[model samples]
Target: MTVKRHDGRKADEIRPMTAKVGVVPNADGSAMFSFGKTVAIAAVYGPRHLHPQFMQNPSTGILRVNYDLLSFSVAERKKPGPSRRSKEISKVTEWALAPAVNLEEFPNTVVDVEIYILQADASTRVAGINAAAMALAHAGIPMKTLVSAVAAGKLDKELIVDVDKEEEDFREGEGATDFPAAKLSGRDEFSLLQLDGKIQPELVPKALEMISSACEKVYEVQKKALKDFIENPEGGNGK
Candidate 1:
């Protein structure tokens, strides 16, 4: 018998999603994305000068991402300032997004992406990546394509897409398998793939297959947000 999701969604179904662009006026570009209760906002500041000349890469502009989960985002307040996990996820976000951005044109410069979670249920990093990708495009940064990301894995014996905090805390035998991934739009290639927990080796392909479809859904929302913002720079609401 197949197991049922706690939220009554089909194993392959994701929660309600929202996307918006041009939310921060002072920023060169900014956007927000949410997967159910997890909301992430991203601001892009530059393809500007890189200070400390020695650190500049003369051949390519670097992508720097800072991901912060606000102290108030969760029920238990986190300490103010960057934690070890936040720092790690920042790098992960950069790598997940670098493939789609064309940075070589702005050599010796840096594009800084700041992502903050206004609320956290789970899969916050994936939400951040979705927002950051739109923010970069909103900033007028050149790009090969936008990126879309999602978390897919198994809750106990059932395969699922877009795991929530409840699924993340599942502690049955073999527990939860959390797989977060990002992909360039319209491509089968994955730019980011991170795994937590366990899954059968044979099931890897199935999970990837599931994630690809999920990313497509994400890409559509991102494209719409960008298009709406362009048509009306009045700042579109999350759709």
Candidate 2:
């Protein structure tokens, strides 16, 4: 069965994307990123002193991430405080971004990344991760490379890139699944890989390949956003 996306994109195509840096003046670095209707804003603070109690490694900086979904971010209003799912997402996001950052350079300090989802469709975490990466770069944090992420899944027996909310519903349930993957730009190593729902073991490799190519495209958009912000800090469009 042939499956067509409502947005008119090809199976391998990603959604329309836009990103901008320096969204929050008070934050050391900030970015607003959107993939179609899903929007996420990320703020980076610190590389500053960490309290004595929380300092786990005296020789390396600590990276912390907080992921939040606004009460009105979805069709049904979400709760105000962090839920268990949010906490897990925060942990994975932190890990996903840590590989790109030079944490050892600022020992006894912390780099805090906060990501807020103002709107959601699907692939919200991926959007948030991409935003957080841009925010870190904006803050002048040393890094190996920026991170880019994308979600791909099997829908109606066909592989699709950047799943939207409707496709994610998977009501028909024909081997549907959500595979979210993230990797450092220009690198083959994966920083995050998550699978939800069912997919044949044989297809896993193909799914990873699709997602990797999608991330490379996302990486180009991320680079453009950072470049634009650096060249036009005062006239940035993120606000």
Q: What RMSD, rounded to one decimal, does every model reach? A: 1.8, 1.6
Clashes of each: 0, 0
Assess the local accuracy of residue 173 in candidate 1 as a C-alpha lDDT between 0 and 100. 81
TM-scores for all candidates? Answer: 0.96, 0.96
**What is the clash count of model 1?**
0
* Residues 4-118 of candidate 2: C-alpha lDDT, one tens digit per residue: 7777889898989998998898899999899999999999998987776566578899999999899999999998999999999999999899999998988888999999999
Q: lDDT of candidate 2?
A: 0.90
Name every residue pair that clashes in candidate 1: none
lDDT of 2 at 131: 97
Cα lDDT, model 2, residue 137: 96
Collision pairs in model 2: none
Off by over 4 Å in 2: 173-175, 237-239
lDDT of 2 at 116: 97
